[model samples]
Target chain A: MTETPSTGQPPEFPRPTAGPPEPTRPAAGPPETPRPTAGPSQPTRPTAGPPEPSGRSSARPSQPSPRSSGASPAPDSQSSPGPSGRSSARPSLFTPAPGAAPVGRMLLAQTLFEIRLLLRNGEQLLLTAAIPVVLLWLLTAAPVFDTGDYERVDFLVPGILALCVMSTAFTSLAIATAYERRYGALKRLAASPLPRWTLLLAKALTVLVVEALQVVLVGGLGLALGWRPSGSPLAVIVLLVAGTLAFAGLGLLMAGTLRAEATLAAANLVYLLLLVLGGVVIPLSGFPSGVRTVLELTPTGALADGLRSVLADGAGLPWGSVAVLAVWAVAGLAAAARWFRWD
Target chain B: MPPCDTRGMSTAPAVEITSLVKRYDAVTAVDGLSLRVAAGTLTAVLGPNGAGKTTTVEICEGFRRPDAGSVRVLGLDPWRDGAGLRPRVGVMLQEGAGFYPGARPVELLSHLARLHADPLDVPMLVARLGLESVARGRTPLRRLSGGERQRIAFAAALVGRPELVFLDEPTAGLDPQARRATWQLLDELRAAGVTVVLTTHLIDEAERLADQVVIIDAGRVLAEGTPQELTSGVSDDVIRFGGPPRLDVASLRAALPDGSSVKEVAPGSYEVAAVVDPRLLATLTSWCAANDILAEGLQVGHRSLEDVYLELIGAAAERTAP
Candidate 1:
């Protein structure tokens, strides 16, 4: 509403005319259609390995007139090459014929598109980026909880990183996907050439991309605040990846199975509950032994605990935490695949 | 032109549905419907609301499973070979059902184009569909007007240049210009050797665009052919006039052609149904003249496609009425 209705290309756009509702017969109709000069070539940006085999359908002997206007749909040189793409010669993308793009390119495009959308949304950015960074600064700036041996920076960094992962992979993804399903976006996508499962794959990839950026920002702040420790870089990646898979699997499960409003409420509630009780901002050791035992088993608690062990404790790898994440990852993914409905 | 019948088509049809039957628990939506959409031709599934048009098309799009029947799209089973066929087929679901609410038209469409190997140029499509004005706006698709959203859906349906596209009411809420533009785009799709299967209740749309028109009622084909064949196929043309009701009907019937039937279809409305010609029309007027009846409004015409459709469905409804 804020933007004025600027006529960017009035000449190019076919404005509504005050004409009769009579359908223009295809055989003979007004020939005033000014063919808009098709601007330029859409470069086939090969995002992945190579161009696909897109040669099943013979390139339409290019429409002669494509018949212009009214009854004739104007066909230009840039029309799609229908039917053949995807399983054919993938290396010859230089003069890409019209057809189905490689599955890899499609997945990559969708992933990037999704990532841009996620980053652009003020709410998603708040949950995934702002909240975690703000939480990191707050806990590090003033020691809210007493830690006997560790500095606040040392204890809060790993835990807040876990918080960032959960916020993105579970809450943000679940809410967005639930809405997309509600709006029939997923159902529409199911009709496209991209397999439905690849959409879920793209979400997982988007989470990892966002999580990497979170690491740089939050981890840099922790370092600036005089935090120093060490853990195997590979171990950190493994933990984060496993945590992502587990959370993403559960996120899609909730999104695909629950109604949009239900997913929205449930995802936010679970995130808040875990943020308080899963040892992200609070220490599990301070609680009763019985409570701590149950907390350690939760995926959120397991991820945080494992991250803390690796970074703050300088451990090689937390196999127990990995085991818990693995179990959740497998079960959640299996269930999502089994019960997810596109409509 | 008289549309070629299925028996005349030498090549394999693009979409062939055989004895499709779909049931929703106890209510059968599609009951033994069989149809053949010839390759590279536009076919309109014309029907009233709740005539199982959506159900039949949805099953063809692989969204719903038919309880009984087989569907082949481009020589592949729609459900089992969905992955293989999806790349070659485009679908625009009813009421703009398949679009994400918050996504912009350009971004979503570009993403879809990438999924296909050779897609129509995105910017070109936008301009072609007359969506340039709203294309760059920050508003999500959900906030745009229904016509704009419909244009985007139309763009999505054609982006991949699929061999066969299913459009479920592609022009429901469009203005005349937009509707005409949509019809043009469909024509262009057909020109490119793509098969188009669209469902609409608009009589003129089917009459103007479809090479094959299938009149469906109660989930079955009542009559189907080119608009010419369908309208001209009925044996008798109706001669109708507004006159005083219930006046000497036997005398009128006896005076007209031997096979002609006359009746007062409504109060003060009479129709002489027969093989109408100038003489027959003249004879009916003379008969009215002789009876001292002033035919208020006299008209002669063959049944239009709409007339055939309404009458066929009315008959079907009576037979199936509870």
Candidate 2:
């Protein structure tokens, strides 16, 4: 590469009043033309640089002449951007045009990355996927509670699915985003040309990806262990999608506003509370009417209601639950959009 | 002048801010700061700890909302047009950003590449950053050195080929050679007409790379100028003579040639300050020769960024102290 002056000023560019003066030395090394070894007027050599004898004060000038030519290539040098060539034509996956297609692509790519990262994390994998599966297996095996005119697996499957969404969206994503904020990762991403919507959608997509895996594993376990779904398969899928959106949106809202440690505490607290109160383990219908009215507004209850209606009762989708989930999703996303701190 | 519009068919400043103020509760992080980064120029924001350098950069990046004043990057408000502005900006934050430990740079780059309008080749980029040897290693992020991780962050930032880039402490812990290489990458970016706004505590870096030196202290701009301009006004040569080898400073100050002032900056060392010709150095050497008083480590010099910074910071602290 051609060595340009270090001023960050292109030749012929107008000098801005705000910029610093041109530096006299490039810090490349001793000047390109070697200074006189002994006297001021020694003939400058083109190459074959003189060797230094250690501790010889004569060669040890206080300031080495700033004339080092062509910096020695380091082991970890970045390759210069080449002119438009063979590889340049192939567009990068994330650089989508400013349209829906690019936005969708960005969301898909980010979601996949998130899922891959979460699955690789031993702690997260155990909590989101393994723990739920283990919990379902253990809970269904015990005879502590009645099947309520249904198979024991029937009641446990939908609840486990709800737990999966909560784990993936509320707990894992919240913790991850909180840490990202604390560490300045999100602030770093904000510097990039990626759209804000693309960033949010990408994160949401990643949660959904993890949730998708959770659904397959838990749903398969439910079927294999004799849990029957009364609702149509299509209705179950719609409900699952809605629940994922709601939980992920809420996760974003919490992660964006709270400190990492605080988010971690709050998410886990919410998770445990919902586990007991939102019908994940206990049925909402079993609660008193006043309690049910309050619980209905929370995302957990709506997710559980939607899941239970589809998986246990085999009933058509409940519009009220759908509306509640939709409201949560919208509100969560909006709140996150307004309050999220990048650093 | 009202703001210069560079939106169409004009080469204008890439960033401009006027008296930018960002206050959080009782603490004002950025106070009455104004700066401009021309298109295709690299401006380094330099300051000591708690100088609000990062806060200022964050405001420019649109990540932090300023409580008062205005900031325009690429002629668009950063917060309002954050998404609209994203495709043209790149950022490399200081720490705690990486993919899952085992994810290859290829995979991560491929994912991030999808978010840009024009992105570089993943394989080529990986090779450039010296990640090719470990390209297939699938090493987890936790295993990489701080320097290696920094490189990964830098690679991620450039993956999008942004029009403007923000680098915060981009080379904090790198070895000398790695730092040089990173500087080369930045130089190349500027050559391609990309605007770079960066922050660093390294004075040598600010002296070498920044087109503009915007110095901040105690949440406000202490000074801004070209390196030469800042240093030039300070008295010229600082002639230091050893003592203990203790020559009486008053006696030496009297014996010094006209236009030189002497002060004891440190015990056993005295500084004779003045702008002098090369002959004055020879004259001093000759004077020591005649007196049989040896002045070892004797040096003549101009004020460096380090000296100016110390003085500026000292003055600012004194003014703000309770």
Candidate 3:
């Protein structure tokens, strides 16, 4: 490739400004010749010539004589509009036109990348997917969870599913985002042209994708152990979506406000607390009568109970649980938006 | 390229700040500072640490909001028009500002490239920055050497083909070779008529690359001029030599030209400040010979940007010291 020649020059003292007597353009002009072929067709084409460089560095000795002849053809092509075959016909070099892909494509790319990162992190995978499946199997076999009225698998499956959604959406996302903020990853993205909402949506989408995998894995294992889900399809879908939105919103709220280590400790602590008292592992029915109402109002309790009613009892849409989740989702998201700090 | 009118007008300076003041709780980071960067020129903001250089640049990049001042980048307020301005501007933050520790160089660069209107060719940029070997590998960004990480950050900043690019300490930890490569790239950017502003603590970097240098200290601008203009402001030439301590300055001054001044700044080192010409040099040597004193390691040169920088910051520090 013609570009390779430019790359071969010694990078040291490459500019003429370093008290070197040699003409700077002799070093710069040859490499710049290949830029048009490399750049997208635009107004930048006209300025890709020797005169352009001289104009900017007028303080430097203008010595375009020796190398200008050798480099003339490159700018010649750039100056003559649309004459070169590649000039007018090529697609945009950088951004898609408005109403083209824009945010959708960027969001999709960010989501895919986020998923890749989540999958690559062994700890994230274990927490979001593996731990839930392992718990589902272990809990169903335990005699302590035997409630006498229903099969143990019937109760444990939906609870673990709710736990999985919370893990992926809240614990894992909060920790990751907090660390990203500490590392300036979020700040860097903020400086870019990507819309802020697209980044948030991409994170939500990543959580959803991971949660889907968790459902398939844990649900498949439940099926193997003779657990039957009797919920209406629409209710299960609504519960899963609402659960994810609520937990992820809470996760971001914490991550965006707290320091990374604090977020890490707090997220794991909340995860464990909800897994026990929020009815994911221990049913809310067993709790004392007074706090049971309050516990049911908590996001985790609402999600687990909602999932249980739909998936185990074959119930219609649990509007009470749905309403609770909607409140948490709206409140958590609003808080996060108000207080989020990229740095 | 000519500065594109992404905001429907192209005549504004690439960056303009008027009476910018930024305070962090009890400390003022930037105080009543104003600067204007002309379009299609390379300007370097030179300052010591804690001089508010980074804070000023961040405001221009729309990353920070100044407490009380106006900042216009390419005819648009950077904060109000960030969405519109970001596409046309590129920023390389200091301290490896926002890279994922686990991301490979190519993955991170391409992800950033998709965010702009007309990004440069990614592979070509990678090659240009001499990141081919690292880009081909899967080593995470945190695992790469400091210089390598810096190069990737630099590439990310330039990949957008922006009309105005802001670089913060672009060559802080780079080796000599890598530093030179970065200078070459800045030159090319200027040739393309892209307005470039860089903040650095290195005086030589500002001297070599900047068309205009603004020396800032203690949250305010100390001086602003071309390197030559700043260096020439103090004296036309500084003559140095190693000689006897406690020289007779009275006799030397009497023998030398009317404007020439001599001082023994160190134990055995002497410096003479004057508009040095052949006659001045002859008079000094003749005076030294007649005094039976030997001048060794004699050298004549103009004041460097570093000398002026130190003097400016030193004076500022003394004034601010309680």
Evaluate fnat for each of the predicted models and list the values in order.
0.32, 0.13, 0.19
- Model 2's C-alpha root-mean-square deviation from the true structure amounts to 11.4
Candidate RMSDs in Å, in order, are: 16.4, 11.4, 13.5
Look at candidate 3 and give me any clashing residue pairs.
Answer: A94-B118, A94-B119, A95-B117, B1-B192
DockQ of each: 0.16, 0.17, 0.12
Query: What value of lDDT does candidate 1 attain over all alpha carbons?
Result: 0.76
For residues B76-195, write the lDDT of model 3, one tens digit per residue. 998898888877787788965688767889988888877664566788778666789989998988789988888899888878777788899999999998787787667556655667
Q: Which run of 10 residues does model 2 chain A get worst, by summed lDDT?
A: A33-42
**Candidate 3 CAPRI-style tier:** incorrect
Give each candidate's interface RMSD in Å.
21.7, 15.4, 19.0
Give the candidate number with the greatest TM-score: 3
lDDT of 1 by residue, B242-315 (tens): 98877767667766656889888898898778854434444555455445567876655555577778888899
Task: Flag regions of model 1 displaced more than 4 Å.
Answer: A1-98, A147-149, B1-10, B240-272, B279-298
TM, every model? 0.80, 0.76, 0.81
DockQ of 3: 0.12
Residue A145 of model 3 has an lDDT of: 64
